[model samples]
Structures are given as C-alpha cells and as structure tokens.
Target: MVSIAQGTFRTVLLTPEGRLLDCRASSVLLPSHDGMIGILRNHAPMLCELQKGIIQVKNIPDRKNAYYLIDGGFARISLNHLTILAYEVITFEGMDREQAERTAALAKESVATKGSFVSNFDEEIDPDRAAFIVKLAHLSEIGND
Candidate 1:
C-alpha cells in the first residue's frame, strides 16, 4: 500500500539543450504518443513515447506549479522518479512578466494570423503549436498579466 508520505515524486524534464526542471511534484500529466497519462508517486516503472503537448507538474513544494510545451520525445518512470526527455521544451518558469506576455501575444497572433511565428529561440511555431502554447500559457497563468 502507498503511504501518505509517498504522495510526491521527483520529476525531471530535459531537452537536448539541457535540464529544465528538477523538482518534487504531487502529480504529473504527460502526453503519451497514444494519449494522456497521469502519474503519481509509486507508479509502476515504464517507458513511453511522448507527443507534442503540455506537461503539467502540480503541487510543487515552495514553487509555483509548472507547465511545459514539449515536442515529441520519451518519458521514463521508475523508483519514484519521472524523467522526460524531449527534443524541445518551452515554459515560462524563468521568464519575467514582460517576456511571458510577449510570448503569449506572439502565440495568439500566430494562431489568429494562421501563419508560422518564430520564437525567441528561433524555432518556428505553426498555428497548431502556437495554439497549444497559448493554452499552456493560460494554464500556467504566466501570461495572464
């Protein structure tokens, strides 16, 4: 039986550039290739392919919850640790209010214009991806200002 102390787990998100997050989270939602997968502490070990979607990390201690927009990659869960390796991951975690607002505006404009938008990272954001970024920004409450 899972103990109450086991309610949280280690979550790490990495991209080819570097590690983006390493924290303790009460829950995590990943976008698997087939569908969405919810994970908690003491989850059975497994590895799965990821798709382009938002990854939500909730109930982080002493930190605001985090949301990541990732391109396709993979996830590994074991021993109370969840690791996500993605080709690209975007989040507003370290951004100032102005940067976050700018990013959200770009995403909204891209979606409305139906044209590809280039991000600060020089990555191209298509309408579908821009829409997802907008959704993530809203969920993270980073661009709400």
Candidate 2:
C-alpha cells in the first residue's frame, strides 16, 4: 500500500447557469482581476473578483488537472475551500468540439475584418472578455476539425 503525500480537497466551480465543475484537487490557479492566484492545501481565507481568463486545478487524487475559461465574476477561498462564482465558464473538457470551432471561427472572422483585434481598444464591450474569448477560440483551433 502507498500513502499519498497529501489528501485531496474538494473543489466546486459553479455558475448561475449550472454546475460547471465539482471535484477534488490539491491545488488550483485562478486568473483574478489583479493577476493569477494560486490556491493550495489549507490556504488562507480570501475573496476575489474574477476576470475573463482561465482557472486551473492541479493534482486531484482521483481527478485530472482541470482548465476552464471563465467570464468575469467572483471567487472565494478559505481554509481548504475554494469556490468560484462566474457568470460564464467554458471548460475545455466540457466544450463540444464542433461548437468551439464555430465560436473560434466567428471571432477570427471578426478580428480579421478589424485587422488585429485591437486588444487595447475600449468599447461598450469589455476588451478583456473579448480577449479571453479569442484565447478560447485559439485553443479550439488546436486539432479543431
């Protein structure tokens, strides 16, 4: 028999739409408004507003490290607990390949029309959110049929 160095902790990622993810993990990295934040075993209490970006989980005894692209929202971490309340989340694993590809294609076409996407431009829309969508679109392009 073998004893693991650490016990796995539970992690639940939810959105108003539904439960995006729920599982256990040893650590998680979240992209917050300020920057990337890391959560690990017995982490101190924290509450943060999230930005459009990715959430990464690492080393769940029974689960794999998970990656999710999330829209702006909020997150909380306390003791060994971590919860993310996002308005929208696109988990790489949960996405339908075809749908993802279509989304990417659409965004790409829009950017192509604009020349470079104007990542620094500010409009009625949040540029950060648009950039995040672009990133997801790019990922979808990887082996994207």
Tens-place lDDT digits, model 2, residues 1-145? 6444256567889888888778888878888899998877777688999887878778867655677777678888776678888875665475676655655555555555643332221222244454566665554443345
Number of the top lDDT candidate: 1
State the lDDT at 46 in candidate 2. Answer: 86
Question: Which number leads on TM-score?
Answer: 1
TM-score of each: 0.92, 0.69
lDDT of 2: 0.67
Model 1: worst 10 consecutive residues (lDDT sum): 1-10
In angstroms, the error of model 2 at 51 is 1.7
What tens digits encode model 1's per-residue C-alpha lDDT throughout 1-145? Answer: 8575467999999898999999999999999999999998889999999999999999999988899999899999999999999987888788787878888999999999999988876799899999998999899885676
